[model samples]
Target: MKFFNEESDFFGLTKLKERFYSSDHDGLSEADREYINRIKGQNPFGIISMFIGGVSFAFGPIYVAFPIITIIFCFLTCGTFDREKEDNPWTFIIGFCLALIGLFMYLRGVVHELIV
Candidate 1:
């Protein structure tokens, strides 16, 4: 009935002793540990946003709004990350760019039709 096990890495692939008590992990303070645990407990919104953005690319010009919306979601999700010192922001940036490309392609088709 133990809620917090010192022997458990909270289900992370590495053992708790190896992950939290090892030399490489020794630099983590209590606040850092709490922050990591809190982040691990949250839903993965960035991945979900990327997935939705990727799926939106398939519907084409008729559903132009979907990609646009996905781009906004990507930006919003990306903004939550610590961009100055981390590589994770690139993932969201790439997703946002894909969504933007899809949106532009969709608009290009409409513009061509109107011009012709």
Candidate 2:
């Protein structure tokens, strides 16, 4: 199994092969490969988050409609962290923190509007 660096624009299989065999490469074992495959098979929370966010933005003020969309976005963002923790702990932490921040901001904005 070969891992392609998606960051690069060049999509040649030769380049991918070279990267796979490069000295800087630290290859994964079969177990690691299986784990990655499992992660890929699992639900992607980022997709859910963006979908909810888009709905919320399109439908107008959250205060006017049911808060279900906002709630779903929060849940999905948190789920993203949970899903990422096994393989990428740092990403899990960062994503979780950012999600929390977004939730807080939304709540604060709602409260501020009500108070004013």
lDDT of 2 by residue, 1-116 (tens): 11222322233433543353344325988787666546533223444444444444433243423234455344433433333323433432333344444455456664335433
In model 2, what are the clashing residue pairs, if there are any?
A: none
lDDT of 1 by residue, 15-115 (tens): 42233333454788999876764453222445666677666655535578888888766654454443332336555656676677668878787422432
Candidate 2 global CA lDDT score = 0.41
Q: Evaluate candidate 1 by giving its C-alpha RMSD to the native, one decimal.
A: 11.8
Task: Give residue 67's lDDT in candidate 1 (0 to 100).
Answer: 86
Off by over 4 Å in 2: 1-43, 66-68, 72-80, 83-116
C-alpha TM-scores of all predictions: 0.50, 0.31
The lowest-lDDT stretch of 10 consecutive residues in candidate 1 is 1-10
Q: Global lDDT of each model?
A: 0.55, 0.41
lDDT of 2 at 44: 39
Off by over 4 Å in 1: 1-43, 83-87, 110-116
